[model samples]
Target: MPKCYWLGWSGQFEYLERAKQRLALVVPLTLALIFLLLYLNFRRLTETLIVMLSLPFAMVGGIWLMWFMGFNLSVAVAVGFIALAGVAAETGVIMLIYLDHALEEARTAARESGRSLTRADLHSAIMVGAVERVRPKMMTVVAITAGLMPILWADGTGSEVMQRIAVPMIGGMVSSTLLTLIVIPAVYGSVKGWRMGRGPLREGAPERMAA
Candidate 1:
C-alpha cells in the first residue's frame, strides 16, 4: 500500500484558509493606514489616541454578532470588519472635533476674562460638546443601521454575502456610537483636565525661579 498525504484543504475550508492568510495581511495594513490618516488629521498623539480607542469597542459588537449568528470567519466578514474600523474611526473623529471646538471656545473665554483654564471649564466643554451636539452622532449610527437592516432581511440573489458585510457594520455602529458619545467625552475631559492642571504648575515655576 502506498502512503497518502493530504496536500491542502478543499472547498470552503480552502477558501477559509486562504482568507485567513489575506485577512492577517490586509487587516493590519488597513489599521496602520487608518491610524496614519488619523494622526495626520489631528496632528497630536493624545487626540489621535482618543480616536483610536473606539476601534476596539467597535470590534466588540461585530465579534459578538458574528458569534451569535454562527457565522464563521470568511472574506465577507473580514471586509465588514475593515469597513467597521473606518466608520468607527470617523465617528470618533467627529466627536473629538466637537470637543475640541468647545475647548477652544473655553480657552478664548478664559483668555478674555484674564483667568487660567480650569477643570470646570473642561467639564463644561465636554458636556456641551458630547451631550448637546449628540444628535449628529446618533444620526450617523441610525442612518447606517437603517441602511443595513434591509440587507439582513434580504432574500434571493447575493443576500447572504451582503448580510455578512452588513452585520458587522450594524453591530459595530451601535457600540461605536455609544463610545463616541459617552466614553470618548469622559476620556477627553480627563486628558484635557490633566493637561490644564499641569499648566498652572508650569506657569508658577517661573515665579518660583524669580523668587
Candidate 2:
C-alpha cells in the first residue's frame, strides 16, 4: 500500500485554478464597465445597443485568428479582449459622433427651411459622415495594428504571453475599423431612414428617393 500526500506551495493545478478564478471575476466587471461606458456615451439605448453589437463583430476576427494560430483562451487573451472592447467602443463612439454631427447638421438645415428630416437627408448625412471619416478611421486602425505588430512578432522570454495579448487586439482592430467605417453607418442609415420614413413624408419624397 502506498499513499502520496506531499504538498509544496499549492499544487500542480493551482495556477490554472487561480487563472480561472481571476478570469471569472474580471470578465464580468470588464463587460459591465464597457456597457456602462457605452450607455453613458450614446445616451440612447438603441444607439448603445448598436455600439455594443460591434464588440462581438470586432471579436469575430480575433476568434478566427486565435484558432488559426492554435492558441487557446488564456488570461492574456482575456486581457486582450478587454483592450479590444475599449478600442472598439472608442471607434464606435467616433463613428457615432460623426454620424450624429452630420444628422444634426441636416436636421438644423431642414428645421430652418420648415421641412421635416427625410430619408434622403439622412442618407446624404450618413454618406458624408462615414466616407469623410475614412481617413481618421484608417489612421486609427493603422496606428493600432502597427503598435501591436512588435508584440505579435516578438520572440523568446515573455513572447508567448505578449502574443496572446496582442493577437486579439490586432485582429479586433481590423474588424472594428471595418465595422466603424462601413457596417455602423449602414445600420445607422437603415434605422434613421426607417424612422424618418415613418414620420411625416415630405413632398417629392418618392421622386427624390427614386432619383
Best by TM-score: 1
Candidate 1's C-alpha lDDT?
Answer: 0.81
How big is the RMSD of model 2? 6.7
The Cα local distance difference test for each model comes to 0.81, 0.81
Question: After superposing candidate 1, which stretches have Cα over 4 Å from the reference?
Answer: 1-8, 200-211
Q: Write the per-residue lDDT of candidate 2 for residues 3-78, one digit (tens) a residue.
A: 8766456763678679889889988888888888777666568778888888899998888888888998888898
Candidate 2 weakest lDDT stretch, 10 residues:
202-211
Encode model 1's per-residue lDDT on 72-180: one tens digit a residue.
7679998999999999988788788777777778777887999987888878878998875589887888888998999988999899999899889988887887788
Measured on C-alpha atoms, candidate 2 has an lDDT of 0.81
Deviation from native of the Cα of residue 161 in model 1, angstroms:
1.1
